[model samples]
Target: MPLTVNEIARLLKVRGVSQYGREPVSQLEHALQCAHLAEQAGASTALTVAALLHDLGHLLAAERDNRADDDLSCDDLHQYIALPFLRGLLPDAVLEPIRLHVDAKRYLCHAEAGYWDNLSPASKRSLELQGGVFTAFEADQFLQLSFSNDALKLRRWDDLAKVPGLRTPPLAWYTDQLAQVALPDNQAVYQRLRMLLC
Candidate 1:
């Protein structure tokens, strides 16, 4: 059976319920913030949905002794883990932005385009692992690739969505919203899921 809106909402609630905070926003809250930001900024429905679910790979990672907040430096684990989750559930348009958000940082550094000056300390460290300061040829190769703009936009929302006091919407919101956009085919399931969450 296709995952029902309620079922998906429950799953997200369970999967994303963070164990800490003032209001203690779930991962769902974070996703919603990103979606709202993108929509407010005039992004396509597709891009907004992609921004909402980009960090979903973290849900599928091997349960470690600690949560993401504990270290925020799991580069190798994230790259490998994101591939399978993205391959199975995400469409190409969504997957590309999710895949490239981090890469965009590295590419920006190589291009020396002044964008890197504002990245947080964490992002700068990740760029070092991705190959600090790309050579001229590498810069060309990175720029030649498409999706930079979308990835940058998504990254911005992804950064801005981390509000400390926001509360996650009631689960019903996800069910109701997703029901409006879900297609029958399984390939559209993630899109449906995203539609609801956004």
Candidate 2:
């Protein structure tokens, strides 16, 4: 299931931007911002990559029309769809952090005391879908998962990436970055299923 360079290129080419929201940023914009912020915070390349692609589920979710708020908000469609597609395409060390990024957000909201109030409506809604507030046991479960620290860092960066007028890096940058990342062949099939956010 590992992604091929061609597959990654196509996926990146599909435009992860969205038309939803008053601010209206593309998915790729959000991801790149998160990656940049994570790098500024000294996150590992793997963690930065996780931040970059964590919302990949949205592409699949949009295609199925399973997106909350008409592709604006919370849902686990990406987790259900994108994760499986990425299984062999990305290393477990890489993919596991992406899988658990949302959980890291949830955990932070509940454990950090004041973090919950800062969550976006989409995040809150998705939290409900993800089973409301995560229990201590759930937090522990995520903590034990691979790349927990990186995921946490990326999750924080993901949230911070949303400032208005923050000039977004072009998709071409990500496309170039993907060239440096190894991917498997046969990734093109997955591209057909993603929602074109651009």
Candidate 3:
């Protein structure tokens, strides 16, 4: 079933407390920071929401000991994991970027000089697991996608969002934005139809 905006928020509230895979900040903190950055940069509502929920796949995947010391071997493929759950709930503007953000990272490393040096240790490690840097052909192919530029912007924000003590608005602050971008509530429509028929 597609998750409601509120249901997504609730899941973030609960599961987002986990440490972001070897990052200093919690998952919620990273998300809020990314959204804050996107908003500060005058991103559209869908882009901002995409920034906020980009890592949601990590949360929806099975609970993990994501602590800095837990050397887990699995690569989770988190970028694609949440799409099935979120497909109908959000617009392509939002969902497409979330799906491509990981690849954006890979693309940037190869396209931009010295980009690889800036990645956090965990990000660098994951880069290898995510198939290393994109080759020239791969980068060109990635650029052809509709939302690839937005995905690149989101990837930049994702990289910068890991500051340990950064302050940003709470998750509740984005509730209205989430609602604005969410799909119409089918259950509510169904109930209204039932009442009309009755």
Candidate 4:
């Protein structure tokens, strides 16, 4: 089932208390910081929400053990995991960016001179699991995506959001914004009915 705004908030408030992979901050802290950065930059509401939830897949990962998922032989692919879960609840504007934010990181490392150096140790390790830096052709292909630019911006915020003890808006603040963007309860049923009619 698609998560409600309250459910989303509860997940962040509860599961998010765990450390973010090996990062210095907790998952909730990183989420709030990224959303705060996006809002301060005057990004669109969808983008702000995307920033807030980009790493939700990590929290949603069932096998997550604070450090377990990070050490897996393969990439956790957290960017894509939550999409099916969030698909109908959020508009594509919000969902697409969340789906692409990790690629945005790979893109930056490939395209920018010193981006690799700036990554935290855990981030660097995860990068290898995330398919490492993109190849030249891959970078070009990634740029062709619709929300790739937004994903890039979100990636920058994600990188900077790891500061410990950094204060940002409360979870309620984003949940309020989320309520505005989330599909109304009836909208899903109406869409299903429409699909059945066709």
TM-score of each: 0.67, 0.78, 0.90, 0.89
Candidate 1: list runs displaced more than 4 Å.
1-11, 19-26, 62-69, 76-80, 86-89, 112-114, 166-183, 187-198
lDDT of 4 by residue, 18-49 (tens): 78877889899999999999999999999999
Ordering by TM-score: 3, 4, 2, 1
TM-score, predicted candidate 1 vs. hidden true structure: 0.67
* Shift of residue 197 alpha carbon in model 1, Å: 27
RMSD in angstroms between candidate 4 and the native structure over all alpha carbons: 4.1
Better of 2 and 4 by TM-score: 4
Deviation of model 4 at 172, angstroms:
0.3
Candidate 2 has an lDDT of 0.65
lDDT of 1 by residue, 68-141 (tens): 43244545444345555435433566567777776666666666566778765656666676567667787677
Question: What 10-residue stretch in candidate 2 is worst by lDDT?
Answer: 66-75
Worst 10 residues of 1 by lDDT: 18-27
Candidate 3, pairs of clashing residues: none
Runs in model 3 lying further than 4 Å from the true structure: 64-72, 185-198
lDDT, candidate 4, equals 0.88
Q: What 10-residue stretch in candidate 4 is worst by lDDT?
A: 62-71
lDDT per model vs. reference: 0.60, 0.65, 0.87, 0.88
Output the number of the lDDT-best candidate: 4
Name the lDDT value of residue 10 in candidate 1: 59
After aligning candidate 3 to the native by TM-score, how far in Å is the CA of 102 from where it should be?
0.5
